[model samples]
Target: MRLAIIGGLAAGPAAAAEAKRRAPDAEVVLFEQGPHISVGTCEIPYLLGGHLEPETTLQVLTPEAMERTRGVTVHVRHRVTALDPRRSRLTVEALDYGSTREEAFDRFILATGARARRLGVEGEDAAGVFTVRDLVDTHAIQRWLDTQPVRHVVIVGGGYIGLEMAEAMRSRGLRASILDPNGRVLGSTVACEASDLMDRAVAEAGVPVRAERATEILAEDDGRVRAVRTDRGELIGCQMVIVSVGVEPRTELAAAAGLRLGDMGGVAVDDQMHTSARSVWACGDVVQIPRAPDGRRVLWPLATMARRTARVAARNAAGSASTRSADRFRPFAGAVGVRAFGVEVGSVGLSLSRALDAGFDAVATDVRHVSRTRAFPEAAPIDVRLVSERGSGRILGGQLVGREGAALRANVLVPLVIGGGTVRDLAEDFDLIYNPPLGPAVDPLKVAASQAMRDAG
Candidate 1:
């Protein structure tokens, strides 16, 4: 069997390796359009802040290592221009040599992932404007910082990337400001109270965050960005602009090949990661999977989801009998984690608003407590909010915010939500490791769950 995988960032490599492992004699080939493969894109902000070296982001896996260890042919700077499902052939372009070739495969996997969404406003093509997406973009940002006199940066979004880059710019002694069109930071994902807390944390770091949208980008004679014009008619001066609005799935190849797409504009795949086309599979950010909380098919561009879905696709491609079972694939619960300033935040399943929107009679309960025992000198404040169905007390969702132990605590709630455990079940059956220096005797999660149960009652 011969397998051809497109897009070698996160899912493509995983699929290639897994396919090789499951079927040792099968020929596996991974193609990447960039010079590097498997870049840790989440760490780009830290590289910009000087906290991490540029080489660290490229350390996830090298193409040579994949070839040497996994017996997979890794082709960097090779772009798949067209897919011929009927012929089982791909029209690929060798970017470095400017050559074109055709590759035949018994099976194909589409892991093209996503590209950064752009604002179509005027002057967006200015020299100093950037979108944080790939290794090339990070290198370009680093070059700008090294060559140009950039003392201030304007981030045009209030999402996770925008907030993280704001913190990164501040660490590098640059004045960072966030301009979000939405009235609140983090938009509707986070509750109002938690959003306010995050906003205050960013503000305290000397990064001014505005709830105004950018009408236009102002550029100088050299076509370098100078400032941003807001919808409120205010000009915010800056030397650089980082646009982090969001990302859209890169499904041009899939759509052109006539693959069915989901409501979320991603390639539609079944539980086995099988696309509508025969002998082809799709995974990563380009495919929409079932979100567990409400069973809705949504686009979740998380690394965890990407890796899991890719492995499933690989197993099916390799003709694994276990993968043939309908129950082999697990649903994604949309688990996520983020850190800004000194606070770490995490959420799993749904938010309070999402639970209500899903037609559940939900009640959210918030609890505040110290991460450690009060007697412990290093104890820090931790806040937990749990959303539960009113009558059944089922744990629909949860959010955590704190200087420490936030993500760890939120991870505990993920299984509960996936298993459909109730708040009362968490209160009665949950066991958390504890010590004076680590955490309180009664876990904060249990406390929050108990409170949720009461609210449900």
Candidate 2:
């Protein structure tokens, strides 16, 4: 089998490695436009915090290492400019030499991740202005920091990435502040209470919050950032600026090749990660995923989705395309949005608003529980909120917020949410762990679930 994988960060390399393992004799080639493949993107903020070295995180696996250990050929500094799915061929550009080549494959996977969203405001392209989406962005920020006299950093958005950069800035003894367009800067995926908790956490870190949008970035004469003017007519002065507004899928190459895109603006793919084109499957941030049960499209641009979908796509691509079997087609298990931010938050499935948008008779119930039993002096409070269908009591979604156990609680909800477990099942069916240092006798998740059941009744 001759398999080609386009992209590298998380999905591309994952599919390539899996394809090589699934078909040992397969000619697997992975192409990455960036200099590094399998880069540690989540650690970019920490790299700014001076907690990690660039080489340690920037390059998770070198092209040489991918060829040596994984038995796969890697092409870094190369971009896939065009794809001819009809011919099962792709046009690749050697970035270093400005040369082009044609590559033929039996099957291909598009793991082309996401790109940083721009503010669309003036002076956004100035020096010392950046977005922390990839290793290249981080390196650019580092280079600017080495030359610029930075004391304060103004973050344009108050999302998870903004919160992380706030911590990173404070760690480096630099002042940081966030400017969000609304009070619920954390976005709708987080419950109102969870947003409040995160707000408090960011405030505690000495980062100021402003409910405004950046209208213009005021830069110095040398094209370096100096200040940002908001729509509110207020100017936020800072030596550096990091725009953490969010990201959109990089699917132009896929779309130009006649691949279908979902309403969610990502490349559309079936359960087997097959795109509309023959012999071409898509995965990673480039594809829109349907949330479990409700089947509503949710933006799951996280690493988990990339890895999971890539494995499925690779397994399918490894088999003979002509002898396709239904039994051999591995279905993509839906995602329960899992993320760890500055406050250790994990929200699975859907939020209450999302449930209503999905046309569910939903009710959200929340409770305050301790991280540990009362006997433990170090026990901290954990906020648990669960959303369930009002009529059938099916678990819809959940959000956990606290200094500890939030991500752990989210893990427990992952299975329940994915398996379509009900509120009653969470309340009465299984026995959860009971170590005083770990959790309460009845887990906080169950406590919230029980409340949800009662509220549904």
Give the candidate number with the greatest TM-score: 1
Off by over 4 Å in 1: 54-57, 188-195, 320-323
Query: Each prediction's TM-score against the native?
Result: 0.97, 0.94
| lDDT string, candidate 1, 128-175, tens digits | 999998889998999998899999999999888888999999999999
Candidate 2: misplaced stretches above 4 Å?
53-55, 189-195, 321-342
True-vs-predicted CA distance for residue 46, candidate 2, Å: 1.4
Candidate 2 residue lDDT tens string, 30-78: 9898888888788788888887875565677888999999999999999
